[model samples]
Target: MIDGLDPEYLDACPAPNLAAMAQRGFRVNGNGMTPSVTNVNNVSLVTGSYPETHGITSNYLLDRQLGEEFYMESAEFLRAETMFQRATACGLRSLLVTAKDKLRRLLSDGATVSISSEDPPGWVVSGVGEPPPIYSLEVNRWVLDAGRYAMSQEPFDLVYLTTTDYAMHTYAPNDPESARHVTLLDEGLGAVLEQAPGARMLVTADHGMSDKTRMLHLPAELGRYGISARAIPVIKDRYVVHHSNLGGSIYVHLDESSDLNAALDTLRNLDGVEDAVSGEEAAARFHLMQERVGDIFVLADPSTVFGDPSEVAMPAGLRSHGSAHETTVPIFGCGPGLDTSTAARFRQNLDVGRYVFEDVLPPRPDGLLS
Candidate 1:
């Protein structure tokens, strides 16, 4: 999975390798599930279903029972079977390589080999027999390097490699840094093609990217109406250096006596606030499970984002995405056995695993379904 690699950004970047690959195959704008957070859409890609089915609706979750917010990092919270699990049940070998440790745990439940960049020593030793620098701006490249090495040496029946989003989070689509990152990623894609010459590869991204020029403190705004609300940014993660928990979507949990409509109206009337809906309404519209959402859902426009009141300022050149405003991702296929006749048809993140399981690799002859 190419994390945070938007189709529009890809088009604007100077990556001839990726452009050529897209030309040889079919390319279409795939819709990401809302809110367009990384983990939410990544789970959607693997489970072939919406957040309502997989139960991971956002990158950060607010637990009513615990009265606390936490980053989502475990597959135990998933409500549906993943493509990796299904493949293993059918006696197919699976390999999972991720730039982030949390994703490895969340998606590697049934994989035969799972390596994460979080454990740099183990990852490098396993693949190249030597460890590189622990962490750097080129972490995504290292993950891809390991993936290519694995494919060349000990190939698996089903392989899923997820990259990092540091570059997309910090650079504009056409910026030199962004273009450089895309070029490196394209080279890694070429390596994968060489390693697995005839594999029916599906190239796609978790979510799109957007520029955040302003921050909306939803909690502070709700306080104007005497409504005490806890605003949980849906994009919160360990990688706060990227966006500082500021994103286009957030959840506001209100007290029992507060006027919900008044709060909603106050937010809607405010600048930068795009839409504010009740949790139930948001669940229905976004295909999210109601129980997992907060009391009120707040979404921002393309130029704005929601965040908690903080003394820390947003870093320069920060970019983020976690709302319907930037929900379009690119999905395509190349190599042998891929059908390009219906490439123009609309697709969503939920279709990725279904296509891979049903089209790329069908059920084994043993009829194993786990």
Candidate 2:
């Protein structure tokens, strides 16, 4: 699910932390698109589609064509349905939490969700009858304890954590700080592994990070074409664009309405555009859009990226997934029911979550499957 972690990176890994996991579990070679923003990539993992079909191209969504201006950050927006909800309808319990609150919402509708944005809240509980997935704002000791409890609880089916994502965002993925963060989270994961040794466990990053010195200005590029990109100034380094008034994915909204090819041509032709293609191209190569993402996409070369760095200040000496830069990430798993077949074939981020104990998530039940 990362770009640069090719065979070369693997050859250099003399450490025991990840190589041992690779030997025991499995490893794959794949490339996440440039602008490998988390929300879009995570949604792709769950829904098995590029942003066009999944409809979450970025954390912040804006569509001028239909007069739609709102936080398209909720997981509920996943093609108006999500895999987490689908899993519950089929009788599996699910737990989701992430700094990307939107993913939790989309994937945990019918299932139980414990989520937080800036913090993982400690005091939210509703387990009996169905309840809107739990959302908390602060990270505390309770979350750690509850995570342990969930790991041991037989009835618990799925559990997700976002604390690491926040830390990775604050600290570069290659940094020692990020490794320390992974260690802390690993303790909790190890607890789960020990308790549910029979259960399937898969670990992966939403996307990898490439250090960036310049954040490419997306709106300014769009503005040059006389299109005002409204969502440019979002605090994070991600951006979203689409047409207003549509139930379709972002690509449909953008392609059908705007001179997308022309817009893309403008984007591709730009001096900074390292690489450009439709989200379709990204989907095919990255295994991203089973549904759709966009007809066009741009994966900036190291020289150019996809945000207005001037608009927001990146953490001091921290740059990971949010830039338009390119980076590589790996997926790890060793659990029950996993297919040991050809583990070396590459896969995208979402493919990691697809099978629980070697069982492919049942086909989505919501009528949207049509």
Task: Give the TM-score (vs. native) of candidate 1.
Answer: 0.93
lDDT of each: 0.80, 0.48
Worst 10 residues of 1 by lDDT: 128-137
Candidate 2 has what TM-score? 0.69
lDDT of 1 by residue, 1-370 (tens): 8888888677787766666666777777778888988889888888878888889988888999988777888987898778888887777888888988889988889888888877754645666654333234477777788887876767589888898787888788878887778878888888887778778777788888888788778778888778888887888887777778888999889888888888889888988988999999999999998888998998888888887557447656668888777888888777764557757543886677777767766665667552
Which parts of model 1 are misplaced by more than 4 Å?
A: 121-123, 129-137, 344-346, 361-370
lDDT of 1 at 329: 86
Error of 2 at 221 (Å): 5.8
lDDT of 2 by residue, 29-118 (tens): 554433455566666665555555666655554444455645555645667345566667667777665443455554556666555433
